[model samples]
Target: MTWQRPASVPVGQVWSRFKGRERDGQPAKMSNWERYIAQGVSLACFTETDGAPDELVAFNITLDLVDVFTLYGVDRYLTSSGLTVLPEHRGQNIGARLFEARKPLCAALGIQCTATVFTATASQVLASKCGYTQLAELSYSHMAARGVDLSGCATPTAKLMGTKFHFD
Candidate 1:
């Protein structure tokens, strides 16, 4: 079945300004998350709770990375904008289920590929288990060299994982 966002749930946006040595202390790059949400889709996992029948446990937002993938000979693909699983829901396989669900969603949408930047070690492992191949990797120390201090972060590296769906 095709998915449609509920009308009652409005998509929100936030503007991010990047400044530092990477940008030479200038606003070289800016991002609006809502724009991505508007242009793409979000998948969520919910559970029944004592207080709330439908409690959000996990979610993943994806956006089309046509511009970035074109150079690689990929016409279009869904690139993860964000992914999260509630702390209390961790270890329940909800995140893995969410990652797995993307296949049917992509087939329904006529999209052939999906990709994500897995910054957490657990997520990278999950992606590997889900059949996503590592396309590239970026280490936190490398980011620090580029002036982005990701020191003290629990994740030491980020990997770009992608898969091409073979819909039946």
Candidate 2:
């Protein structure tokens, strides 16, 4: 149950090759792939790593400014694109913990948090656990209109959820 804390992102694929050739024979000093390494303010986790603690996550994020408001609108917020815990990690409440981790990062910038997920109780439960309320639920066919491509989705519906927060 050892979780490797967040650290600088590993040298990226493009950069790794650059370093490989530049420092021939010398290994690149990169960060470990596990536990829940935070790169900047990204809400992410690694469920698999090299000999590292079983990093757990099936999540994606969108940092673009979501137009979730019209009156008294805000600019940007952390979007939890998806959070699918591995089958083995089910019932562990990892999603809740991960979402909890995202709060402060947003609060520091005075921004709210949002998420979109299918009707599945799992994700809805996670969102609820994180204090987000459902704003709407859309059909999978409409995903493309919302800039979603569900060819990779396991379900047909994803709910839009959000919550207000402050640093104080």
Candidate 3:
């Protein structure tokens, strides 16, 4: 399979499908969507066969951030977001293939790749398999905001952490 970043492809189609279902009660904010389109590039993986859209099994969004500077000599953090494989295409290692295609794109942009996964079992497994590490675990005060009970949980807030993969 080969992956290419085509400028004419409709990235919003895949992004809306994945993100709309993930976040409830709100359309993906248009401003954020625009920013993503401006700051990120979309990759599509396809088979060699002609007219084989079905073989176009995976999609990813890689965001480039060059405005922030850190001591590690890193200026960009490439985020891998909205990774989705067709339902019939699961268990085929397509996700890993899609990620492998992204490495060169990150290097070309001079960015350190990272992704954030919520406290979900599947996400944690996939992120770890993709070479991401757990940088920090965070807690939130849900009761104060959402007025919900989180007695058994350590904290109502979700975890937010950073992970890095270097291509050099």
Candidate 4:
């Protein structure tokens, strides 16, 4: 099923839910969720309501990425950073559907979409499966030197991926 985000959901509600959940035996930190929301990025969570016991299984957070676009000497680009799904709800295609929802959004906004897939995360596979082209691959050590923490990540490298519907 495609992603379904309720209009009434709140970030705090989801943050609480992810707090005690484990990804690779490491419980997801509430700080991560808070930082994602505090960045003032747009966020959406996927709710599986097609059957009984509807639930929030996944989420996607997008930013305008104006700064990055400027660095590239262009504009009209979006960057999606938080692509998360509950561990218990994974392998059900929730991540793919959430990622797919961005296609129409990009078309409507006339912007290209980009995101990153970290090693050992389902996002690496999900990004490819959702038709995002691999743009670059950077090792964790390189990212760490840039002041970004990679301790929690399981992958050796993080891949940047992109999808576009317009040339200009």
Identify the candidate with maximal TM-score.
Answer: 1
Stretches of candidate 3 exceeding 4 Å from the true structure: 1-40, 51-55, 67-73, 138-168
Candidate 4 residue-wise lDDT at 46: 36
Candidate 1 residue-wise lDDT, 88-168, digit = tens? 556667677777777766665667888888887888898999899999989999999999887876898889998888877
> How much lDDT does each candidate structure score?
0.65, 0.52, 0.50, 0.57
Which runs in model 2 stand beyond 4 Å of their true positions? 1-39, 45-68, 117-119, 141-156
Taking the tens digit of each residue's C-alpha lDDT, what string does model 3 give over 1-168? 233334554343222112112212321212233343454466554433353333344556565555453533565565656666655446666666666656656555445655453354455566668766666554445444566554554434444335555664
| Each model's Cα RMSD | 12.4, 12.2, 9.7, 8.7
Error of 2 at 106 (Å): 0.4
Give model 2's TM-score versus the native structure: 0.56
lDDT per residue for candidate 4 within 1-168, as digits (tens), equals 322233343333322111222234422333345455453434445333353323444567775554454433456566766677767656656566666666655554456655554465567777777777777888889878899888788778888777665544
Better of 1 and 3 by lDDT: 1
Q: Tens digits of per-residue lDDT for model 2 on 1-168?
A: 332223433322111000001112322222443333343344544433363423324343434354546432665555644465555444656566666656665554456654555456677767877788887888778877878777566667778787766555
Among these predicted structures, which one has the highest lDDT? 1
Of candidates 4 and 3, the better by lDDT: 4
- Candidate 4 similarity to native, TM-score: 0.62
Error of 1 at 42 (Å): 0.7
